[model samples]
Target chain A: MCQLLALSCAEPTDVSFSLTGFAARGGLTDHHVDGWGVAFYEDRACRVFVDEKPAYRSPVAEFLKSYPIKSRNVVAHIRKATQGGARVENCHPFMRELRGQQWVFAHNGDLQPLGDANEPEHGPYAPVGTTDSEAAFCFIMNRLYAHFAAQAEMHADVDDIDAVFEIIEQATRTLNPYGIFNFVLSNGTAQFAYCSTRLSYVIRHWPFSSARLVDGDLSVDFAERGTPADRTAVIATTPLTDEVWTACEPGDLLMFRSGALLRRAHVPVPDAVLATSKYALSELSAVPA
Target chain B: MCQLLALSCAEPTDVSFSLTGFAARGGLTDHHVDGWGVAFYEDRACRVFVDEKPAYRSPVAEFLKSYPIKSRNVVAHIRKATQGGARVENCHPFMRELRGQQWVFAHNGDLQPLGDANEPEHGPYAPVGTTDSEAAFCFIMNRLYAHFAAQAEMHADVDDIDAVFEIIEQATRTLNPYGIFNFVLSNGTAQFAYCSTRLSYVIRHWPFSSARLVDGDLSVDFAERGTPADRTAVIATTPLTDEVWTACEPGDLLMFRSGALLRRAHVPVPDAVLATSKYALSELSAVPA
Candidate 1:
């Protein structure tokens, strides 16, 4: 498995502190050395940066650690490469535009091979890379697009974003027969997360306190960063800080909008399916050598 | 009009030298001072960086100047907002995915309003921002996708990329009714440039000589940076160097692939339409004080 980190805030906020700790997982504190990517959302647009180099070693990542690019929503991933090579295309997160809104996605788990092609061919979802994560994102996007097209109401029903949210919950269930599919997707307005194997999150709001990094020595007091009016939700494969994190069970699909926990839809996939995950392969990787 | 720059090379080459001079135009040597963007392509996937801030002041642009991010295809734009607000989404070098390949476009001119909506609504082709440039891009994409769908051969006909090339050429002709439409489009393999007003290019090959930047004091001996086997084509809104640049007349659609001139298709539009352009607004803007 790789590292997944996402943040949704009430206001445009910087992710430099959390990014510092999250980036450490790439060849610093952990062994996810394939590549890393980050997306910072600005309304309907997002600026995405991806590198084939390890996050801890990438100059882009280093610049991000100091650059205060304020955004209401952010998603970052450090990849270990389960299905694709360590190329720039294979790096997470992937970006696509459907119906004017730009979407970004990052995955941290394996799947039981969609088998569109043994070669790196983009069959239906149109993923340029060989990663199953991108395929899964496109699968959900196709489902959303088809949902509107089947109704012969591609334009009329688009304002109903809640419809898309339910479709995502349903699509995650359809993909359950694969393997661990923990991934985070965002559309600038909100962040959607599905927990298939391991995921945790912490919501910070009024009366915030200082939090120390779990992966590094850096500490940031929320009081110094902002007033109590600010709110945010930080999600990751594991807790990135020493703050209290709520561990999500398998098959939990959550939505965070404007730094608030909008809702949660638990896709009840059986626990037995997690048995087929690429646990053996991930465990065999050399850690912090 | 804004400045546009593109590079197509036989090998992965960095644009540090050209970018350094180009970045100077944003709030510096000359006044475009809206925003700037760059897309470095690695096959179908590209790493795009855009800042709503002026390029000369943007830290991201500063980093790109020192960083050697090499790619076979690169496209960049320094914007002078003609239709949309100065925002990242409205930044040049907008990207969209079609057939799994990322297509990036940067336009230097305006168009007669494609009046689908009075507001910033994504009508028909689905542009998230209120820019005529994006609408034009989406319109072309729709025509291309419709061409495949109309034939009932969406998947099968994709292998014939030459068909897509011809379609793009024809589409450029169709868009000439719109006002000044100088733009560059790339899909990692090649660069397609359509010059509506002012544009020029230089092809560098073996036995390269020194060239001096017109916007800056720096000079570079390309022979030191490249070998006899290296070949590249650098296109810009105006010649960026003191070297000989073949000025492209209006209606010139040129293609450069793997450092070689593939073909040039001149889409002749009546010269009288340039009178209707937003030339007054551009000239009225304050230049370098």
Candidate 2:
């Protein structure tokens, strides 16, 4: 397992505090010491910084902690090397170009039947690395390509983003039988998050207050950096700050845009996992959307 | 127009020295101050550093000068916008994935008939930014995909790289009439460069000596950082150091791998440019490869 963090905001906001706390888990506070990566989206394009070195000690990570590169959508990950070696290619937050948009994806959990020599069946998209996370990302890209291949010239016509989210939901549900499929994906238009085992999120709006980091001694008052109309949604594998964070129930798929919840759907519990974590589920599957 | 620089080495080598001199052009010595970007390849993957700010004054560019990140294949570009606005998305050294390899490209000249909104017909590839350079790159990628999409399994069987080079050559020839289209492309396996207006290259091998930067007041001895077996081939829009560099004839396409020249082919001169620079061509078209 690893750590995942994502942020969606109404306005482009710097994520220095969140990244500093999250990077500590790569080598300082916790043991996800394999590699780390982050993608910051700006106007359909993205700037990705990845390091095979443990994030806590990486020079790039150190630089990013102080550099305030603002972005509306950002995805970050710290890996523990569950599937592949500690090579730069195996780092998380894999990216691809589709429909004239730079799409980013990162997985926090391991998947089975991957990390082998043989690649899973995919179209147009292929994994450049050997990790299950990259393979899973490519699988989602392939699914999206297949869904829109029949469309006309305007492939970027993802005006109805919910329809795109549904495809991502189905894609995650299809890979549920493989193993933990918790992941975060984005294409600057929206942020999609799927939780199979563990995930949490917090939204900060107008009345922002100070919050202390759970892993470090640093604290920041959101009011100092945000305006009355600003809104920001932060998602992570575990709560990073001493603020109220709603724990995402297993099999929950959440979508956010402009720092607000766009949609929420409870995934249908797979038959294979029905017996193992039954007690973990108090509500029935397909609760609401 | 923009400035482009690329390196292909027998072993992983840090490009800090070259980057220092080249980055100076972004704001210090020259006027390519719109933005800058560089992609450093690490085993089939790459780390890209880009800044919308002037490279001479950017913090990221400052950090890179001191950092010794190494790579076997590297592509860098500093842009002066002509087709697109100075946004992060319009920065050069664009990247895409093809055949499970991270393909990178950087353009150094403006192209005509591509700035308008009507996108050229392409395959699965698309441009994320409104730049003629990226559109030209997508056109090349479409041609390559059209040539190889018919292969059965094993799409990565690019053993016949010459055939791949031929496709790129033809693609360049097809777009030759547009305007200046100098570019450098790589997938870690090999480096391909095409010159339509201006390009130059120099190879440093055994018994390496010192050289001074033409754009800066710095000098370095290659023997201090290289072994006898180390061979570094550098291609740039202009020679960064005061070393002997071979000027590439217009319409020349060069392929290199492991720091050694593989092949070179001169594209047939386009009828549009035949009248303007006929005196420049001393050799016939289709030069020895």
Candidate 3:
């Protein structure tokens, strides 16, 4: 398993104080000695650094800690591959450009039962390494491009905001059948998240308090954050379990803009097998609120 | 930007069918081949495969594609190191065990200012690699053990559902100050997910239609497998763009059990800054919903 870290604040702030303990797990204490990467947003642009080295051992990871680059939105990941090859190309926190905006993404799961490659209308981007994660990313971007292009033919305002949301919603569901798809993606403007099988979230608001990492000795006081109006949210495969976390039900999709929930869509649960032997456990399963 | 895939079904199903196209992107069709791995959940146990070669070139990845392993829960990942060393150890979808159950995690971001490593109090479980991801995993287990022990001291009900949830929640938030912490975690029975900056999700039901991968040309028809009684959910970094995906707010943590939402908690957000600085862009800022 891998680890992911991110921060979205009312104002850009350095992640130093918080990252201290988290970084130690990479190599100094943890087994994800694989490569790691981080990305921070700066005025509609992202400043990112990726390396095929553990965050603890990598001089670059250290430089980042000291450099203290600040951003309102940040995405990060440490790799533990389950598919493909291990190389720089497979490093996470991958970046892509869409409509002149840089989009960042990282993943922590694998899709088995791989299918044959389909030719992109454009020439193949070609894999640098052999990780299925990167390939999936490319496929997503390529499909998004195609979807946007297809939509552009009918709608001039691709960012009509409403259309973008509707379109994105449709796209996400289409990919669900492929396999477990757990990812974090960001455009300089906002961060989008989804939950399928194994995901959890916590929305931290004004009433902040001191929190410490169970993984390391680092701690942070929300009181030090200056403004109590700041709203920060953290999401993960498993609830970090250090604070109160909420679990999303299957088929629920949510949207976030500026560290707040904007919209949500709940995929309907089919009733075909409510009382059948196939879903007997599910029928008896009562979600603990 | 990287790709993530997972499979959590009522029964075991091979992921290689879907993995083929995903793997091609790294070396064949795309470029994410740093390393590759896949896991199959058989009852409570998971059978996994990891290779350092490009999936397109690796005989192992090929073998898995044709293999039909099945399980109720599975997690997989590919690598694209952004930080840390790119050795065999630094792969995605790391696995561990605690309290007699196997736990797996994968990440797609980087952590800066990594703190000192803190091994789980349970034992000498240490990271083999240097990525912050693994360190985080060990930390979680340690915290769980500590929580359980603390409960034992109070003579609390070890089986108390609320107790388990509370401990997990606290552990998650504790990791935040470190950096962007987004991940997918599973204990073979339940899955946990979170979003720190960017993530999204989508869920599917019985009427599994033929789906075409946006990244590749292959298509799968779910109608052939079973009736419309099946239901599943998916979470990812970005909405798949071609499917119906939901976005998670910056700091929303959620939990999932048996493919359903179990609970939720919102972390506190910081205060909002008055727009005194000229840096504020009136056109881009949108009020959160």
Candidate 4:
């Protein structure tokens, strides 16, 4: 239904090179051309650029290509409009502020029934756009807020990372039954990715080598561009560079902080859900190009 | 401490002409060189450009000057950073989402003790930056959410405009005692402006005349650019154009919807507070150049 890209780094780094190749998929190399968006975090604050235009031809995207806005965390998306109109509001990554922090999310797959069935209860978080992806994000945020509220009522601190991870994992597992639900989320400090069927990531560190884009005639030598202490990771629906990309399994949830993988959990898909997944696969395979 | 600019219009209009003159104040004309930001709303969605660099010299601002991104509501700020560091996080205008709508705010005055004294209690909204402006915004949002929650619990619809206006007015009155508190706020549909000491506005409609920038060598004939149906209202800390501008009185709050003034109120300022306001005026007058 769409494509997602994300980067997390130990130091603030520019993503122009990677973004150039990724943006090609917006209309040049692929057909996710309905709209596109990108968000970059500078410390605890974020700057977001979104356009209801093909990223490959958007003036804003072109400016960003030459302008080096460095960030520690970045999330981007190219939409094919599986369920929503091709309006500016339907563009990702969608952002909402929670617990005094801004959280950004981008989705790459469809979750059909979740859009209507999982109606968000009266809560502070709500979806402004009519997309299954945004509904899912709002649902997750509402759950997180509820969890925090419960913890606060008990007079306990809500910074327990383990507990938060468990809640997110449970929510992702519950939504996976509806359909493919691959997504990336961040709160300026850490990034979380959940793979339902298709996702890959690559980590780069010292002793880096040059890499070429798989889709475009572009290449960058990491050794020339980064310092010896630099560490970075890029995540995408499909690998953008000719590098070692690790394929995430069907139900893998990965947590990353400071460019390093912090945790991984393999949540098994239910047998009944797996049996009906052929329809989901066909739905994804039918993405327009 | 900062300069604020906003536009509300019946039609989607480009603000490049006014923005050119306003941006000059960032470094070229006056000195609000700490940072600058602008937000444009497209329906319920928004695109914002912010830079820690001075606006007059920032490549991002230069790109914006030529890019024709049309919006019905827009807010811009050039910061002098009276209370916060010159970082991206401290830049205005700040944004948060509530009730599925994005709310943007920019402040042009100081609230000295309020920044530290009014530590936000545990709430759904909180400041991500260490600025008095952001703290004030959070305080307002928290109050709005509380009012909405109470209304919901009582089985009342939360869209009563009068009630919402009263709540906002009361909040602004409460903050005015802390220090100078001029601000502009919008939720993509309507705009709210409050003037503690200095602000001005101009309404342009049919039979529009030529206008010249006060801060730069630029002029525009609105009659040549806009249709007879076009109506626009521009608000700024100081008049941007050499036209008949209406000065907003001290403690004046104006609400605008669809480029027309919808409501106005003059909350009384305390005599003691007014006596201490001379220092605030001098601080603003001393803005570096």
| Candidate 3 TM-score for chain A | 0.81
DockQ-based class of model 4: medium
Give me the runs in candidate 1 sitting further than 4 Å from their true place: A117-125, A150-159, A278-289, B117-125, B149-161, B277-289
Error of 3 at B75 (Å): 38
Per-candidate local distance difference test: 0.81, 0.82, 0.58, 0.83
- Ten-residue segment with the worst summed lDDT in candidate 1 chain B? B116-125
What is candidate 4's lDDT per residue for B1-289, written digit by digit as tens? 7889999999999889889988999888887899999999988788778899999999999889779788999999999988889988889999987777788999988785664434434457877888889889988888777787766656543345556677789999888888788899988888899988778899988888999988888889988987887889999988888888899988899988778888999876666667776776666543222
Per-residue lDDT of B100 in model 4: 70
Compared with the true structure, model 2 gives a TM-score of 0.92
Candidate 1 root-mean-square deviation in Å? 3.4
Q: Which ten residues in a row have the lowest lDDT in candidate 3 chain B?
A: B269-278
Question: In terms of TM-score, which candidate is strongest?
Answer: 4
| Models sorted by lDDT, best on top | 4, 2, 1, 3
Identify the superior model by DockQ, candidate 2 or candidate 4.
Answer: 4
DockQ of each: 0.46, 0.55, 0.01, 0.62
TM-score of each: 0.93, 0.92, 0.45, 0.94
lDDT of 2 by residue, B100-157 (tens): 8788899976677654333433566788998888888888887776677666355545
lDDT (Cα, 0-100) at A253 in candidate 1: 93
Candidate 2 lDDT, tens digit per residue, A151-216?
A: 655554555688789888888887888777789999887999988877899999988899888878
Backbone N/Cα/C clashes per model: 0, 0, 216, 0
